[model samples]
Target: MWRPSVAGPRGYRVVENADAFDIARIRPDETAVVVGAFGPFLKALRGIGARHFVLEKDPATLRPDEMGHFRPAESYPRIVPQADVLLITGTTLVNDSLPGLIACARPEARVVLVGPTVPMLPDAFLDRRGMILGTVRVADAEALHEVLAQGGSGYHFFGKYAPRIVLAQD
Candidate 1:
Protein backbone atom coordinates (compact mmCIF):
# COMPACT_ATOMS: atom_id res chain seq x y z
CA MET A 1 0.00 0.00 0.00
CA TRP A 2 2.72 2.44 -0.96
CA ARG A 3 1.38 5.95 -1.33
CA PRO A 4 3.09 8.46 -3.63
CA SER A 5 2.60 12.02 -2.50
CA VAL A 6 0.26 14.03 -4.65
CA ALA A 7 1.97 16.06 -7.34
CA GLY A 8 1.32 19.48 -5.93
CA PRO A 9 2.72 22.18 -3.69
CA ARG A 10 2.26 20.16 -0.52
CA GLY A 11 4.14 17.26 -2.08
CA TYR A 12 3.48 13.55 -1.38
CA ARG A 13 4.23 11.27 1.56
CA VAL A 14 5.55 7.73 1.87
CA VAL A 15 2.99 5.09 2.70
CA GLU A 16 3.08 1.31 3.23
CA ASN A 17 3.73 -1.43 0.67
CA ALA A 18 1.18 -4.07 1.61
CA ASP A 19 0.04 -4.08 -1.99
CA ALA A 20 3.22 -3.08 -3.81
CA PHE A 21 4.04 -4.71 -7.19
CA ASP A 22 7.36 -5.44 -8.92
CA ILE A 23 8.96 -5.66 -12.37
CA ALA A 24 9.10 -8.89 -14.34
CA ARG A 25 10.72 -9.34 -17.72
CA ILE A 26 11.91 -6.37 -19.71
CA ARG A 27 12.95 -7.39 -23.19
CA PRO A 28 15.85 -5.66 -24.89
CA ASP A 29 15.21 -2.77 -27.27
CA GLU A 30 11.63 -2.39 -26.10
CA THR A 31 10.12 1.06 -26.30
CA ALA A 32 8.80 1.44 -22.73
CA VAL A 33 6.74 4.22 -21.30
CA VAL A 34 7.52 4.50 -17.57
CA VAL A 35 5.02 6.23 -15.37
CA GLY A 36 6.33 7.10 -11.87
CA ALA A 37 9.94 6.07 -12.36
CA PHE A 38 12.41 7.41 -9.78
CA GLY A 39 15.99 6.08 -9.26
CA PRO A 40 17.69 2.76 -9.94
CA PHE A 41 14.86 1.45 -12.06
CA LEU A 42 15.39 4.28 -14.50
CA LYS A 43 19.08 3.47 -14.73
CA ALA A 44 18.37 -0.22 -15.29
CA LEU A 45 15.94 0.64 -18.04
CA ARG A 46 18.51 2.79 -19.77
CA GLY A 47 21.12 0.07 -19.44
CA ILE A 48 18.81 -2.30 -21.29
CA GLY A 49 18.52 0.15 -24.19
CA ALA A 50 14.94 0.97 -23.39
CA ARG A 51 13.74 4.17 -25.02
CA HIS A 52 11.55 5.86 -22.43
CA PHE A 53 8.85 8.48 -22.31
CA VAL A 54 8.52 9.51 -18.66
CA LEU A 55 5.31 10.97 -17.21
CA GLU A 56 5.29 13.09 -14.11
CA LYS A 57 3.11 16.06 -13.24
CA ASP A 58 5.43 17.47 -10.61
CA PRO A 59 8.49 19.26 -11.90
CA ALA A 60 10.04 19.08 -8.43
CA THR A 61 9.96 15.30 -8.54
CA LEU A 62 12.26 15.29 -11.54
CA ARG A 63 15.90 14.79 -10.65
CA PRO A 64 18.30 17.01 -12.54
CA ASP A 65 20.94 14.31 -12.84
CA GLU A 66 18.65 11.66 -14.29
CA MET A 67 17.03 13.99 -16.80
CA GLY A 68 19.80 13.23 -19.25
CA HIS A 69 18.52 9.69 -19.72
CA PHE A 70 14.79 10.24 -20.28
CA ARG A 71 12.62 12.42 -22.42
CA PRO A 72 9.68 13.89 -20.59
CA ALA A 73 6.54 13.50 -22.62
CA GLU A 74 3.87 16.17 -22.91
CA SER A 75 1.48 13.90 -21.10
CA TYR A 76 0.47 10.31 -20.58
CA PRO A 77 -2.24 10.70 -23.18
CA ARG A 78 0.30 11.44 -25.84
CA ILE A 79 2.87 8.87 -24.76
CA VAL A 80 0.98 5.63 -24.07
CA PRO A 81 -0.14 5.04 -27.61
CA GLN A 82 3.38 5.24 -28.97
CA ALA A 83 4.93 2.64 -26.69
CA ASP A 84 5.57 -1.07 -27.14
CA VAL A 85 5.51 -1.64 -23.35
CA LEU A 86 4.05 0.27 -20.40
CA LEU A 87 5.79 0.13 -17.00
CA ILE A 88 3.57 1.64 -14.36
CA THR A 89 4.09 2.25 -10.66
CA GLY A 90 1.17 1.67 -8.36
CA THR A 91 1.23 4.77 -6.25
CA THR A 92 -0.63 5.16 -2.96
CA LEU A 93 -3.12 7.63 -4.30
CA VAL A 94 -5.74 6.33 -6.65
CA ASN A 95 -5.03 7.44 -10.19
CA ASP A 96 -8.26 7.75 -12.15
CA SER A 97 -6.20 8.62 -15.19
CA LEU A 98 -4.97 5.03 -15.47
CA PRO A 99 -7.86 3.78 -17.59
CA GLY A 100 -7.11 6.36 -20.22
CA LEU A 101 -3.55 5.07 -20.37
CA ILE A 102 -4.82 1.53 -20.85
CA ALA A 103 -7.17 2.66 -23.57
CA CYS A 104 -4.36 4.36 -25.36
CA ALA A 105 -1.96 1.42 -25.39
CA ARG A 106 -1.40 -0.57 -28.56
CA PRO A 107 -3.29 -3.86 -28.52
CA GLU A 108 -0.08 -5.82 -28.50
CA ALA A 109 1.61 -3.83 -25.78
CA ARG A 110 2.85 -5.61 -22.68
CA VAL A 111 1.49 -3.67 -19.72
CA VAL A 112 3.35 -4.20 -16.46
CA LEU A 113 2.25 -2.79 -13.13
CA VAL A 114 5.01 -2.27 -10.52
CA GLY A 115 5.46 -0.94 -6.99
CA PRO A 116 3.81 -1.87 -3.69
CA THR A 117 0.52 -0.08 -3.98
CA VAL A 118 -0.84 -2.09 -6.88
CA PRO A 119 -4.25 -3.63 -6.33
CA MET A 120 -4.42 -7.36 -5.83
CA LEU A 121 -7.83 -7.69 -7.40
CA PRO A 122 -7.16 -8.93 -10.90
CA ASP A 123 -10.25 -7.23 -12.26
CA ALA A 124 -8.69 -3.86 -11.61
CA PHE A 125 -6.30 -4.42 -14.52
CA LEU A 126 -7.04 -7.86 -15.94
CA ASP A 127 -9.38 -6.78 -18.71
CA ARG A 128 -6.87 -4.16 -19.71
CA ARG A 129 -4.19 -6.82 -20.35
CA GLY A 130 -2.18 -5.80 -17.29
CA MET A 131 0.11 -8.32 -15.61
CA ILE A 132 1.90 -8.55 -12.26
CA LEU A 133 5.65 -8.80 -12.73
CA GLY A 134 7.24 -8.89 -9.23
CA THR A 135 7.51 -6.93 -5.98
CA VAL A 136 10.42 -5.33 -4.11
CA ARG A 137 10.46 -5.98 -0.41
CA VAL A 138 12.57 -3.54 1.51
CA ALA A 139 14.08 -4.35 4.86
CA ASP A 140 14.28 -0.71 5.86
CA ALA A 141 11.63 1.62 4.52
CA GLU A 142 13.37 4.43 6.41
CA ALA A 143 16.57 3.89 4.42
CA LEU A 144 14.59 4.14 1.25
CA HIS A 145 12.91 7.23 2.59
CA GLU A 146 16.28 8.81 3.28
CA VAL A 147 17.47 8.04 -0.24
CA LEU A 148 14.35 9.54 -1.73
CA ALA A 149 14.64 12.50 0.60
CA GLN A 150 18.10 13.36 -0.69
CA GLY A 151 16.95 13.06 -4.32
CA GLY A 152 19.02 9.92 -4.51
CA SER A 153 17.17 7.62 -6.84
CA GLY A 154 17.64 3.96 -7.73
CA TYR A 155 17.67 0.80 -5.63
CA HIS A 156 19.85 -2.24 -5.44
CA PHE A 157 17.98 -5.39 -4.52
CA PHE A 158 19.74 -8.47 -3.32
CA GLY A 159 18.71 -11.73 -4.97
CA LYS A 160 16.35 -9.90 -7.27
CA TYR A 161 14.30 -12.28 -9.35
CA ALA A 162 12.02 -12.00 -12.36
CA PRO A 163 8.40 -13.10 -12.37
CA ARG A 164 7.20 -16.40 -13.74
CA ILE A 165 3.75 -16.22 -15.26
CA VAL A 166 1.66 -19.26 -14.55
CA LEU A 167 -0.90 -19.71 -17.31
CA ALA A 168 -3.09 -22.24 -15.58
CA GLN A 169 -4.26 -22.39 -11.95
CA ASP A 170 -2.47 -25.62 -11.25
Candidate 2:
Protein backbone atom coordinates (compact mmCIF):
# COMPACT_ATOMS: atom_id res chain seq x y z
CA MET A 1 0.00 0.00 0.00
CA TRP A 2 2.86 2.33 0.70
CA ARG A 3 4.56 3.15 -2.57
CA PRO A 4 6.23 6.03 -4.40
CA SER A 5 3.95 7.53 -6.99
CA VAL A 6 2.50 10.91 -8.01
CA ALA A 7 1.68 12.43 -4.59
CA GLY A 8 2.36 16.13 -4.93
CA PRO A 9 3.84 18.91 -7.04
CA ARG A 10 7.15 17.97 -8.67
CA GLY A 11 5.84 14.43 -8.13
CA TYR A 12 7.18 13.62 -4.70
CA ARG A 13 5.20 10.50 -3.89
CA VAL A 14 6.65 8.58 -0.98
CA VAL A 15 7.32 11.73 1.00
CA GLU A 16 5.16 14.87 1.47
CA ASN A 17 7.26 17.96 0.75
CA ALA A 18 4.38 19.89 -0.78
CA ASP A 19 2.53 20.00 2.55
CA ALA A 20 3.03 22.37 5.53
CA PHE A 21 4.35 21.76 9.05
CA ASP A 22 4.13 23.59 12.38
CA ILE A 23 6.12 24.37 15.49
CA ALA A 24 7.17 21.32 17.46
CA ARG A 25 6.47 20.86 21.15
CA ILE A 26 9.77 20.32 22.88
CA ARG A 27 10.66 19.97 26.55
CA PRO A 28 13.43 21.53 28.53
CA ASP A 29 16.66 19.67 29.39
CA GLU A 30 16.50 17.58 26.26
CA THR A 31 19.80 17.47 24.43
CA ALA A 32 19.34 17.49 20.68
CA VAL A 33 21.52 17.20 17.59
CA VAL A 34 19.73 18.47 14.52
CA VAL A 35 20.67 17.01 11.12
CA GLY A 36 19.69 19.95 8.94
CA ALA A 37 19.75 23.76 8.95
CA PHE A 38 16.56 24.44 10.90
CA GLY A 39 17.43 27.61 12.77
CA PRO A 40 13.98 28.30 14.14
CA PHE A 41 13.70 24.89 15.79
CA LEU A 42 17.12 25.24 17.33
CA LYS A 43 16.15 28.62 18.73
CA ALA A 44 12.95 27.20 20.13
CA LEU A 45 14.82 24.33 21.72
CA ARG A 46 17.26 26.73 23.30
CA GLY A 47 14.39 28.90 24.47
CA ILE A 48 12.95 25.87 26.24
CA GLY A 49 16.33 25.24 27.91
CA ALA A 50 17.33 22.36 25.69
CA ARG A 51 20.91 21.93 24.64
CA HIS A 52 20.44 21.94 20.88
CA PHE A 53 23.11 21.73 18.17
CA VAL A 54 23.40 21.53 14.41
CA LEU A 55 25.10 19.08 12.10
CA GLU A 56 25.53 20.17 8.53
CA LYS A 57 27.04 18.32 5.63
CA ASP A 58 28.64 21.37 4.07
CA PRO A 59 30.92 23.10 6.55
CA ALA A 60 31.11 26.04 4.16
CA THR A 61 27.41 26.74 4.76
CA LEU A 62 27.97 27.60 8.40
CA ARG A 63 28.67 31.11 9.59
CA PRO A 64 31.90 30.53 11.50
CA ASP A 65 31.28 33.10 14.17
CA GLU A 66 27.58 32.47 14.67
CA MET A 67 27.50 28.68 14.51
CA GLY A 68 30.99 27.67 15.45
CA HIS A 69 29.71 24.58 17.24
CA PHE A 70 28.07 23.18 14.13
CA ARG A 71 29.54 19.73 13.60
CA PRO A 72 30.16 17.83 10.39
CA ALA A 73 27.41 15.45 9.26
CA GLU A 74 29.85 12.52 9.19
CA SER A 75 29.82 12.44 12.99
CA TYR A 76 26.19 11.32 13.07
CA PRO A 77 27.12 7.90 14.33
CA ARG A 78 28.97 9.35 17.27
CA ILE A 79 26.60 12.19 18.17
CA VAL A 80 23.30 10.35 17.72
CA PRO A 81 24.01 7.70 20.33
CA GLN A 82 24.73 10.22 23.06
CA ALA A 83 21.87 12.64 22.40
CA ASP A 84 18.55 12.49 24.23
CA VAL A 85 16.79 13.79 21.14
CA LEU A 86 17.64 13.75 17.43
CA LEU A 87 16.17 16.30 15.02
CA ILE A 88 16.24 15.62 11.31
CA THR A 89 14.62 17.07 8.23
CA GLY A 90 12.21 14.91 6.29
CA THR A 91 14.63 15.22 3.40
CA THR A 92 16.43 12.36 5.11
CA LEU A 93 13.54 10.16 4.02
CA VAL A 94 13.64 11.55 0.53
CA ASN A 95 17.36 10.83 0.30
CA ASP A 96 17.04 7.35 1.88
CA SER A 97 19.19 8.20 4.93
CA LEU A 98 16.44 7.77 7.52
CA PRO A 99 17.02 4.07 8.09
CA GLY A 100 20.70 4.32 8.84
CA LEU A 101 20.23 7.42 10.95
CA ILE A 102 17.54 5.72 13.01
CA ALA A 103 19.75 2.70 13.46
CA CYS A 104 22.50 4.80 14.97
CA ALA A 105 20.32 6.25 17.71
CA ARG A 106 19.83 4.73 21.14
CA PRO A 107 16.44 3.05 21.61
CA GLU A 108 15.45 5.55 24.26
CA ALA A 109 16.36 8.63 22.27
CA ARG A 110 13.52 10.64 20.84
CA VAL A 111 14.34 10.57 17.14
CA VAL A 112 12.05 13.10 15.51
CA LEU A 113 11.71 13.60 11.76
CA VAL A 114 10.58 17.10 10.95
CA GLY A 115 9.35 19.01 7.87
CA PRO A 116 6.78 18.47 5.13
CA THR A 117 8.69 15.69 3.43
CA VAL A 118 7.47 13.05 5.88
CA PRO A 119 5.02 10.42 4.76
CA MET A 120 2.03 9.46 6.91
CA LEU A 121 2.68 5.76 6.60
CA PRO A 122 4.63 3.97 9.31
CA ASP A 123 5.00 0.58 7.64
CA ALA A 124 8.70 0.47 6.81
CA PHE A 125 9.48 1.91 10.21
CA LEU A 126 7.80 -0.90 12.14
CA ASP A 127 11.04 -2.06 13.67
CA ARG A 128 11.97 1.25 15.22
CA ARG A 129 10.95 2.70 18.58
CA GLY A 130 10.88 6.14 20.18
CA MET A 131 10.64 7.71 16.72
CA ILE A 132 8.34 10.62 16.07
CA LEU A 133 7.19 12.20 12.81
CA GLY A 134 6.70 15.92 12.93
CA THR A 135 4.54 16.45 9.85
CA VAL A 136 1.47 18.43 8.69
CA ARG A 137 -1.77 18.26 6.83
CA VAL A 138 -1.74 20.39 3.68
CA ALA A 139 -4.09 23.32 4.16
CA ASP A 140 -3.75 24.96 0.79
CA ALA A 141 -1.86 23.00 -1.83
CA GLU A 142 -1.78 25.86 -4.32
CA ALA A 143 -0.54 28.34 -1.77
CA LEU A 144 2.01 25.87 -0.47
CA HIS A 145 3.22 25.29 -4.02
CA GLU A 146 3.59 28.99 -4.66
CA VAL A 147 5.51 29.53 -1.46
CA LEU A 148 7.72 26.53 -2.16
CA ALA A 149 8.54 27.93 -5.61
CA GLN A 150 9.69 31.07 -3.87
CA GLY A 151 12.02 28.98 -1.67
CA GLY A 152 9.85 29.17 1.42
CA SER A 153 10.02 26.55 4.16
CA GLY A 154 7.85 25.93 7.23
CA TYR A 155 9.07 29.26 8.58
CA HIS A 156 7.47 31.12 5.69
CA PHE A 157 4.26 29.19 4.99
CA PHE A 158 3.02 27.33 8.06
CA GLY A 159 -0.30 29.07 8.78
CA LYS A 160 -1.19 29.62 5.14
CA TYR A 161 -0.35 26.36 3.43
CA ALA A 162 0.53 23.94 6.20
CA PRO A 163 0.19 23.26 9.90
CA ARG A 164 2.32 21.04 12.11
CA ILE A 165 1.20 17.56 13.12
CA VAL A 166 3.03 14.86 15.06
CA LEU A 167 2.94 11.09 14.46
CA ALA A 168 4.50 8.27 16.40
CA GLN A 169 3.99 4.61 17.20
CA ASP A 170 2.37 3.85 20.52
Candidate 3:
Protein backbone atom coordinates (compact mmCIF):
# COMPACT_ATOMS: atom_id res chain seq x y z
CA MET A 1 0.00 0.00 0.00
CA TRP A 2 2.75 2.43 -0.81
CA ARG A 3 0.61 5.10 -2.44
CA PRO A 4 2.68 8.12 -3.46
CA SER A 5 -0.40 9.92 -4.82
CA VAL A 6 -1.91 9.97 -1.34
CA ALA A 7 0.54 12.73 -0.39
CA GLY A 8 -0.89 16.18 -0.83
CA PRO A 9 0.54 18.89 -3.08
CA ARG A 10 3.43 21.07 -1.96
CA GLY A 11 1.41 24.24 -1.73
CA TYR A 12 3.71 26.42 0.39
CA ARG A 13 6.59 28.43 -1.05
CA VAL A 14 10.22 27.44 -0.43
CA VAL A 15 12.65 30.28 0.18
CA GLU A 16 16.10 30.92 1.65
CA ASN A 17 15.12 32.07 5.14
CA ALA A 18 11.62 31.69 6.50
CA ASP A 19 11.71 35.37 7.36
CA ALA A 20 13.67 36.46 4.30
CA PHE A 21 10.81 38.78 3.38
CA ASP A 22 10.71 40.23 6.88
CA ILE A 23 14.45 40.46 7.54
CA ALA A 24 14.57 43.90 6.02
CA ARG A 25 11.59 44.86 8.12
CA ILE A 26 13.65 44.12 11.27
CA ARG A 27 15.09 47.58 11.52
CA PRO A 28 17.55 48.90 14.11
CA ASP A 29 14.90 50.82 15.99
CA GLU A 30 12.11 48.26 15.98
CA THR A 31 11.83 45.64 18.69
CA ALA A 32 12.03 41.89 17.96
CA VAL A 33 11.15 39.20 20.47
CA VAL A 34 12.79 35.82 20.05
CA VAL A 35 11.28 32.90 21.96
CA GLY A 36 14.26 30.59 21.52
CA ALA A 37 17.99 31.20 21.46
CA PHE A 38 18.38 29.83 17.95
CA GLY A 39 21.93 30.63 16.80
CA PRO A 40 21.54 31.75 13.18
CA PHE A 41 18.58 33.99 13.82
CA LEU A 42 20.35 35.52 16.81
CA LYS A 43 23.42 36.15 14.66
CA ALA A 44 21.29 37.80 11.97
CA LEU A 45 19.58 40.02 14.51
CA ARG A 46 22.91 40.99 16.00
CA GLY A 47 24.36 41.71 12.55
CA ILE A 48 21.43 43.99 11.88
CA GLY A 49 22.05 45.68 15.27
CA ALA A 50 18.33 45.45 15.82
CA ARG A 51 16.96 45.97 19.31
CA HIS A 52 15.67 42.58 20.35
CA PHE A 53 14.84 40.62 23.46
CA VAL A 54 15.42 36.87 23.56
CA LEU A 55 13.12 34.85 25.80
CA GLU A 56 14.74 31.56 26.57
CA LYS A 57 14.34 29.13 29.45
CA ASP A 58 17.91 27.92 29.15
CA PRO A 59 20.66 30.50 29.54
CA ALA A 60 23.27 28.06 28.21
CA THR A 61 21.90 28.41 24.68
CA LEU A 62 22.83 32.11 24.64
CA ARG A 63 26.28 33.44 23.98
CA PRO A 64 28.09 35.69 26.46
CA ASP A 65 27.24 38.82 24.50
CA GLU A 66 23.62 37.71 24.24
CA MET A 67 23.18 37.53 28.00
CA GLY A 68 22.24 41.21 28.06
CA HIS A 69 19.29 40.62 25.77
CA PHE A 70 18.02 37.54 27.58
CA ARG A 71 14.62 37.64 29.25
CA PRO A 72 12.90 35.03 31.36
CA ALA A 73 10.00 33.06 29.89
CA GLU A 74 7.69 34.61 32.46
CA SER A 75 8.27 37.98 30.84
CA TYR A 76 6.95 36.97 27.40
CA PRO A 77 3.43 38.25 27.97
CA ARG A 78 4.69 41.73 28.74
CA ILE A 79 7.43 41.79 26.12
CA VAL A 80 5.84 39.94 23.16
CA PRO A 81 3.02 42.43 22.68
CA GLN A 82 5.57 45.22 22.20
CA ALA A 83 7.57 43.47 19.49
CA ASP A 84 7.37 44.45 15.82
CA VAL A 85 8.53 40.94 14.96
CA LEU A 86 8.56 37.63 16.84
CA LEU A 87 10.87 34.68 16.16
CA ILE A 88 9.36 31.67 17.91
CA THR A 89 11.00 28.27 18.03
CA GLY A 90 8.93 25.43 16.50
CA THR A 91 9.84 23.34 19.57
CA THR A 92 7.10 25.28 21.30
CA LEU A 93 4.64 23.04 19.50
CA VAL A 94 6.13 19.99 21.17
CA ASN A 95 5.97 21.73 24.55
CA ASP A 96 2.34 22.73 23.90
CA SER A 97 3.19 26.42 24.33
CA LEU A 98 2.98 27.56 20.70
CA PRO A 99 -0.60 28.74 20.97
CA GLY A 100 0.04 30.76 24.11
CA LEU A 101 3.21 32.27 22.66
CA ILE A 102 1.48 33.18 19.39
CA ALA A 103 -1.37 34.74 21.30
CA CYS A 104 1.06 36.98 23.20
CA ALA A 105 2.03 38.90 20.09
CA ARG A 106 0.09 41.85 18.80
CA PRO A 107 -2.29 41.20 15.92
CA GLU A 108 0.02 42.90 13.41
CA ALA A 109 3.29 41.44 14.66
CA ARG A 110 5.34 39.50 12.14
CA VAL A 111 5.49 36.02 13.70
CA VAL A 112 7.95 33.43 12.42
CA LEU A 113 8.11 29.86 13.71
CA VAL A 114 11.50 28.32 13.01
CA GLY A 115 13.45 25.09 13.73
CA PRO A 116 13.71 21.53 12.45
CA THR A 117 10.51 20.61 14.27
CA VAL A 118 8.25 23.04 12.39
CA PRO A 119 5.56 21.29 10.38
CA MET A 120 4.90 22.22 6.75
CA LEU A 121 1.35 23.24 7.56
CA PRO A 122 1.00 26.82 6.35
CA ASP A 123 -2.70 27.36 6.89
CA ALA A 124 -2.58 26.04 10.44
CA PHE A 125 0.28 28.35 11.41
CA LEU A 126 -0.94 31.34 9.38
CA ASP A 127 -4.36 31.02 10.98
CA ARG A 128 -2.60 31.15 14.35
CA ARG A 129 -0.71 34.39 13.48
CA GLY A 130 2.46 32.86 12.05
CA MET A 131 3.87 34.55 8.95
CA ILE A 132 6.64 32.10 8.12
CA LEU A 133 7.84 28.52 8.76
CA GLY A 134 11.57 27.88 8.79
CA THR A 135 12.32 24.19 8.63
CA VAL A 136 14.25 21.54 6.70
CA ARG A 137 12.95 19.07 4.09
CA VAL A 138 14.70 15.80 3.48
CA ALA A 139 16.26 15.75 0.03
CA ASP A 140 17.83 12.31 0.52
CA ALA A 141 16.11 10.21 3.10
CA GLU A 142 18.85 7.58 3.16
CA ALA A 143 21.55 10.16 3.70
CA LEU A 144 19.47 11.87 6.36
CA HIS A 145 18.97 8.59 8.15
CA GLU A 146 22.68 7.91 8.02
CA VAL A 147 23.46 11.39 9.37
CA LEU A 148 21.01 11.00 12.24
CA ALA A 149 22.35 7.54 13.09
CA GLN A 150 25.82 9.06 13.38
CA GLY A 151 24.63 11.81 15.75
CA GLY A 152 25.10 14.53 13.15
CA SER A 153 23.20 17.79 13.33
CA GLY A 154 22.11 20.29 10.69
CA TYR A 155 25.73 21.28 10.09
CA HIS A 156 26.37 17.88 8.60
CA PHE A 157 23.13 17.03 6.76
CA PHE A 158 22.09 20.49 5.57
CA GLY A 159 22.74 21.06 1.87
CA LYS A 160 23.53 17.36 1.45
CA TYR A 161 20.67 15.32 2.86
CA ALA A 162 18.31 17.86 4.42
CA PRO A 163 18.07 21.21 2.69
CA ARG A 164 16.80 24.22 4.57
CA ILE A 165 13.42 25.41 3.32
CA VAL A 166 11.36 28.37 4.43
CA LEU A 167 7.70 27.63 3.95
CA ALA A 168 5.56 30.71 3.43
CA GLN A 169 1.81 31.14 3.17
CA ASP A 170 1.05 31.92 -0.43
Clashing pairs in 2: 22-164
lDDT of 2 by residue, 1-170 (tens): 11222333222233333221122345676677788877666656656777766878876665554285587788888877767878888888787777778888888877778767777665555455656666777889999999989998778876557765555543
RMSD of each: 10.5, 7.7, 5.7
**Model 3 Cα displacement at 131 (Å)?**
1.1
lDDT of each: 0.54, 0.66, 0.75
All candidates: TM-score: 0.60, 0.75, 0.83
Model 3 over residues 86-130: C-alpha lDDT tens digits?
888888989888888888888988888777788876667655443
Clashes of 1: 14
Whole-model alpha-carbon lDDT for candidate 1: 0.54
Worst 10 residues of 3 by lDDT: 1-10
Stronger candidate by TM-score (1 vs 3): 3
Off by over 4 Å in 3: 1-12, 16-25, 128-130
Q: Candidate 1, after superposition: displacement of residue 64 in Å? A: 2.5
Identify the candidate with maximal lDDT: 3
The lDDT, on a scale of 0 to 1, for candidate 3 is 0.75
Where is the poorest 10-residue window by lDDT in model 2?
A: 1-10
